[model samples]
Target chain A: MGELALRKPSGTLVALVAHTLRLQLKSALIWGGVLGAYAAAMVASYLSFGDPQQMEQIMAAYPPELLEAFGITDMSTIEGYLAGQVFNLAPLALAFFPILALSAAIAGSEERGTIDVLLGNPVPRWQLVVGSFVATAVSLLLIVFIMGAMMYGTAVLADTELGFVASVEGVLNLWPISLFFGGLALLCSAVFHRRALAIAVPGLVLLAMYLADTLGRVSEDLEVYRDFSVFYYYAPEGSAITDGIDWASFFGITGLAILFALFAVLVFRRRDIYT
Target chain B: MCAVIYTEDLTKTYGKARGIRDVNLTVEEGEVFGFLGPNGAGKTTAIRVLMNFLRPTSGRAEVFGRDTVKHSVEIRSAVGNLPGEFALEDKMTGERLLKFFARLRGVKDLGYARELAGRLGADLTRPMRRLSRGNKQKIGLIQAMFHRPPLLILDEPTGGLDPLVQEEFLRIIGEVRGEGRTVFFSSHVLSEVERVCDRVGIIREGELVDVEPTDNLVNKSFRHVRLVFEKPVDPGPFRALNGVENLCAEGPELRFTLYDDLDRMVKLAAQHRLVNMEYERPSLEEIFLTYYGASEEEDRDG
Candidate 1:
């Protein structure tokens, strides 16, 4: 666990990304900047909702399905629109970064033959995997937490009456969803040992899940496909956009993560380190 | 003597390609075993398998009495490995990379890594990506030796270094061997192996053809001798010379494999016009080629 701590999930994640990002402090600033901009944009959209005439006009422009697809089902009021902006559009940015982050831990290491150098030590492969996963998970959790905090602040500033707890809940709802995507990406990295494949994996996963969700909502015959996408469990359909904390769903996603991570480790161990 | 590194008909395949096949090898404890082969002879593959980077297709490999595949963690804990090719991260400073590997190997300080790197003339400040091939090899060597593992597996470890650095690498090996650790290192270059290795294994394609002490293998093999005379004469009389293998005759020149004592041959040659006489050492490269047998995949079935 000492070496495991060194390869801790957050550290592993940071290690992966720092190198690819040239280990410059700029990438961190850049991610922070993006979240800040998203927060600002959500606040601007909510401000437009302060005008009843403009709010009604904006709501009529996009259909409920389109808004829901974007996780923006309500622009009827300021707080609702902020919820739409954070849970829907924001998770995409957070979900995929961690995959890139985690895959960098192994895919990049294996690619460069650095895995040989690192594994030449006494540390077990399981520790390396766990450390990498933990690093990725932590980085992702941090990114989502910052985004959630910013969005919650934006929701309150737009409508001063909005409850901080409700706003925070809406923001936090996206963590497990991001984890599920991160797990999916980890599974892909285990299967395909190349960085290109690892980089493209998260996108393909999200696309497949989106298609599954579309199929789930469209026709009666295709409803079974909804079970395939973890997004189905995270769909924002509550009154406060993310009413109470869904511990069961969050834990369910965590369970999925453990399963995916275990599968990835087992698969990784059985095969050769692909050059 | 106990075998520090041993293999019993070890086999490894990638898809349909032969990685290593039916390779029976043994490295005595504290002996420096040089794995000799041409490029793609599975030198790297075999080492990778022994290091647990790859699983064997069949058969077994053991390091210090531990199964390479099953007890990989234990094997790794006790082995230092240097791969043939590795791209260092451009972002990490050389100091950082060395420290990371040293720490991973359970070293509290980078003292040993820095010592080896300094002896090898590596620049710790520069990013590894910026280093020259020779310098990168220095880093690879440093990382593997930092832990002082009982068994060191190096694959093509000294390709880009100059003679001076090559000498330094040899010195490191000597120091390691003096401590009673076994070194299993590979090189396509024969002279290097001839100079340092106590025991050497010749691998061609994916097969292990021969394994013997350096002096014994060299003494047992034939040298191609070429002699010149003032006039043409039948050289067939010398064909039955003791220890000779391949024999050939040409006008005014006699060429044959010389396995017999060179002193007798020099006396025999002193009788001739002796326009010119020279013997060329049979290269280990040529000896390695004997095992390639065309393509790697084709020889597996045979």
Candidate 2:
């Protein structure tokens, strides 16, 4: 075979990953830019909260249970206030980017009738699953880095006190959580042929977990269920911005992401590609 | 001769819908094999199984002596496939897409790819979304044939092309054959298959009905025969001929299908003052209908 004579023993996986990453770069920049702008706006608005005590007093007027439900512990500092405002809620929206992208990796391609052409190459099925997950994971990190740079740059331009290290940690903390949902979406994409189902399943799970972690804080009866939520493990409240990275929650979430990705590879390898 | 494509009792079932059943076939090396079938006749299903896109429900398939499922990557390494219904990335230009595919296949040189684009008149600079269906199909054909693989599996390869472009594609297939590479393609168009394929396999209702050489298939089928006399001739003698079917007789005009015994029919017509005769080959569809219709009749008679 003349074609076989040119074959390399490896690098197909790397090429697949690189190709997927290149395809995702434009979307990554778009998602990162939008989220980063939101973060920059939040940092700029923090300048209006002139006195920490005054801002604390205003936040204290709200119901304590509602504040706790929203993870609003202390607005007395920029990190504390922004943590509850940005990092706490940003992952809920940002995770969907990966969810939408990863859901389309396999099932969405099949729906578009593009999977046949992609899989027509000699790349292994597992490589498709793993390569897509790896590319999306890297793209998620790019989004986080962009958002972090925006947050820190805005702080420096506004002459605010948001430390570069803390901002980096805060944005990087979103990676594990967002990637967790991305992994779930990958698994769903592998298991289901319908792209809508792949997206909707993980999307619903994200919403339910958010509600479980949020409502569980307000209701005594629901508190027991908080541990079941992925958000429970993702306690970025004072951990990311104030103290440091919570290695336990960080590795725990990352581990779950890896698990879901492995499951996706296993499931996808055996299934028929409809497209 | 070693078989380039082999399947033994290969079957695939999608829920209640029949995909393919007991398909045992072998396409030897260096021959152009045409898979002929109507829509929903399991042509795509069988091709998908061979590509390992769909798993076989039972039995097995092998390409170049490697099991399709066990060594799909190795098999695919030697094969180039063009799907029946395929879409490229809308944001990507054809040049970029081919380069990416080349990278995946570890193909360093794009000289052949560029040559294919030139020959097929594919616009590699434009994004896939901007191209018309025929343009996209040109790109699709280029991508499949560019690598010069050992075997090419194309499904309805000429779906959206003008006649001139279709002629160009046939020439390319002929060249591939001349190079001793195998081409196994599926199509509903019989004329193209007749022109390019060495052998044609007819599939009907999820089963392989027949596989025969192109000449044998065309020669064995019936032909449309018309006879005109100077005056109204008796239709009785012609009607009594053994192989004549669907006989129709009017004043000075007689038309019927002749299956065999052409000489006997010619001698019978010689007795009358034969004014003119019109003998034409039946179309592939007509032959297909006759084949299936006779089989169904056989079932009823049994």
Candidate 3:
């Protein structure tokens, strides 16, 4: 009918995501608080052991099990630990903040019955999908930038100088990491219309990936499974925290984010527009 | 006739459950046609199919000669819809919703929208969550009619308005008719349809029973006459009267409904000292049950 009514680029969908992200900016505060506490602890440990060898010794004694569980190993070393400790906490921060924001974004509209009115309008179905995806993507990037700044700001207060390069690398990890989950969250929101699943679906998937990564690290038997986990692609171990930035992994994860977002769009097109 | 809306053996089924079955209807240009039916009787489903909200299982339906799915956007652009299951964005005020609808339809000026809001008592400033259901219905109506589309596919368009507001809505429909545009409305209220619609299609259990003019229906369907007497009434004299279908006599009055002409009947009532007299039209529900019968099985068996 008249070439599908000249679909708009979905400004409304973008608007929905932007509003959701703005509501969760305090995530930066949460990320900052965690980084600040870790920085404080690192400073005390550094003061106790003035020797570089002693610093390495104390770093080895750090709870390897807990550290491994969180995908935080290389970050424990003096040079590497500075960035690792800050970026390591990102997955947790993302699992909480942006999810709370998404809970209000997708499911919230349908819960209030506003989805019916939107469906009645001339707005195309895919626009709703992509608009929401773009909105959350933009928001997740903002959270990353804000938290990155906070981590850099916290690293400055450390007695041991972790240079700007290390700090930049630490904060940069948040982009790819957050993008993976952000796309996943949008996908979940598209699938489910409940606050619990809207947050839990993506959050659990990310957590499960981190857990799978840990299990793989403890034994070679599960190593192959790591490739399937988005967590593995999120922050490639040999990248920033290992002293070299992995552009391949970084861009690969970014590409994965686009793929996840595209999947969300495709799924939304076939499914019934919720009443 | 060039039907503004029509269907050819149209059917829509949701999995094993049927939504509308073989619903074939045609509304002439400029006539106020009422697609009357009870709740869950496939009225809304049929409307949804016509709007391309749902795909038909079999048969075909077209609006302005365009397939609903292929041309919903084009057909919808020319058609205004007020969904039977009314819902609107709560964060937006009545004014904002109107503006949004107007803008969605490409209304460049707020003046026209403002005029409709004023006439309909729609407060555009307050968010939709604060407005009453009647107010919400008003907003929906304003959006539907503001564009002044030549065709309207309204599903229970006046669900929540008070009687006065309902009358106001009817008056607007009358005006729409005067402008020579087709107003295709569905409602559970039979009298409303009887009062406004030039022709009506009574639907029941996903099937259309009959389609005819309101006046012809009123004249041929049933005739009800109320006669209040000066003294206690007797059932015997009234029941024996010619053309009497049903006659019930109370102690002091007779309330009876009869078929055929009333000239001889009125003379019979005058013979017995009548205190007051009244005549009534058959309700839409009466015609509804009469035409569609009761159940799907009953209609099929008939």
Candidate 4:
């Protein structure tokens, strides 16, 4: 018989997190590479435009509501341009990385008939929920880091006026909001056994929140409704690039992610795990 | 021997769906216990309850003297389980999967895993998606046995294995028993249970009908008896004998199901100048059908 290690509570959690992270590394890199390349391309496009002032003039003619709707705070600078072109819209697509990953953690594992074999070991149910969330949270940061590198690297090569710190703030701010959606997916994943519902619930929420917050910015009548949308708290008016990351919203969105994950832990702990 | 597993009135139900009900069972240490039932007979449900995968609707269960629900992790630490239906990660090779599980289990060595893989002919190098059903089953079995856990809870363990692999698996079960470890496996395959199980629990329609020594369950059940007289004899005397049932007479041959009173039947046959005699013990499958035949019909009808 092989020698067995004494089962420690912390050790099990670490092992689970490490295992889940390892499985998620490839997907994270692929997501990061794709989105990073897009961000880098946006930086290149900004540089290719002959003069920043002329580009700002053209953007100014587009109307303030249209600019606000697109989350363009200032188009005269690369920070503003990349914020509008990449980071603002990036969460809409990039958030799905963690959303898809976290949703698969529980409900997806059940659908695939893989949960039984995994939970058959000494893993606690809460560990499955928390470990997946922690790993995915880390994976989300990796994606953000990769996007940051690509965006900043392109800015440096093109001699754009974008600051390294501003670029860092722009990409770093994407983490919490993306993770907030991932948290919802994890909650859904825990509450339901079907993976489709887990993904769809969060997907629909992401679309609705984006539209509510975007339209709220364009119309006074819809302004109150923006408070209900998570996007309301995610980089309002592209402030993360100009004013640096809003510490309040950063932690708030992160807090919400932890809240949803906590709820997931509670719900998953009480329910019977199928398959 | 102390009880390794004990459950009292353990029941689990899925809304209107039937699950196990009032299942009280005790499995002693170092014994191979077989849970026998056909499909949808709550065998999997019962096993799930024991594993704490499904909570009981009423009553409770225990393993290693600890509550199944509260001490599940500790119980699982000492147990090796193979679920009735499971899928390994498609991207993971069998070796990688085992290593991951070993890490989770805090086991540092893969030597036993490798040995079991070799013995079972499990190809650990290939990804799970590339393996056939039988090959997947071999991996499943290896994972359950590799850690050398004290209690092995295997559900429908040999479902997809070929005969040769099944034989090797039974041999492994024998070795597990030799090591004084307990095995609790559920299967609808009667011959497999008969070959390895010391005690067999028969469940029907979401309830345990009987639990007895395998030998007793097989031996005490009815057998088929045939007698050939010198010439055509009246079947009345044979039918009148105690415990004789379903008597049939054709020419000089007499055949019937004998449930009891073998001595009296033999004496009666001797009086008729029995030219030949054949007595055969029924298989466990036949015995299961015979014992539960009425309830099975009632289930089908209602």
Task: Give the TM-score of each candidate.
Answer: 0.83, 0.93, 0.82, 0.90
Evaluated at residue A263, the lDDT of candidate 4 is: 100
Interface RMSD of 3: 5.0
Candidate 3 docking quality: incorrect, acceptable, medium or high: acceptable
Runs in model 1 with CA error above 4 Å? A1-29, A48-53, A61-65, A105-108, A149-167, A194-202, A214-227, A239-244, B221-261, B264-282, B289-302
lDDT of each: 0.73, 0.90, 0.69, 0.89
- What is the iRMS for every candidate structure? 7.1, 2.8, 5.0, 4.2
Q: What is the descending TM-score order?
A: 2, 4, 1, 3
Best by the DockQ measure = 2
How would you encode candidate 3's per-residue C-alpha lDDT over A152-222 as one tens digit per residue? Answer: 55556554565667656655666776777767766677677675787788787877887777677666788
Ranking by DockQ: 2, 4, 1, 3
List the candidate 4 regions with Cα displacement exceeding 4 Å: A1-10, B221-286, B296-302
Name the runs in model 3 displaced over 4 angstroms.
Answer: A1-60, A74-86, A92-112, A149-172, A175-204, A238-245, B221-227, B260-267, B271-283, B300-302
Share of the reference A-B contacts seen in candidate 4: 0.56
True contacts kept of each: 0.47, 0.62, 0.11, 0.56
Candidate 3 per-residue lDDT, tens place, B71-190, comes to 666677677788776667666676666655655666667776677677777777887788888888888887777777778889898788888778878988898899888899998787
Indicate the worst ten consecutive residues by lDDT in candidate 1 chain B: B287-296
State which candidate has the highest lDDT: 2
What lDDT would candidate 2 get against the real structure? 0.90
Q: Model 2 compared with the native: what TM-score?
A: 0.93
Q: Model 2: which docking level applies?
A: medium
Model 2 alpha-carbon drift over 4 Å, by segment: A1-9, A236-239, B224-244, B249-255, B260-283, B293-302
Each model's DockQ?
Answer: 0.31, 0.51, 0.24, 0.38
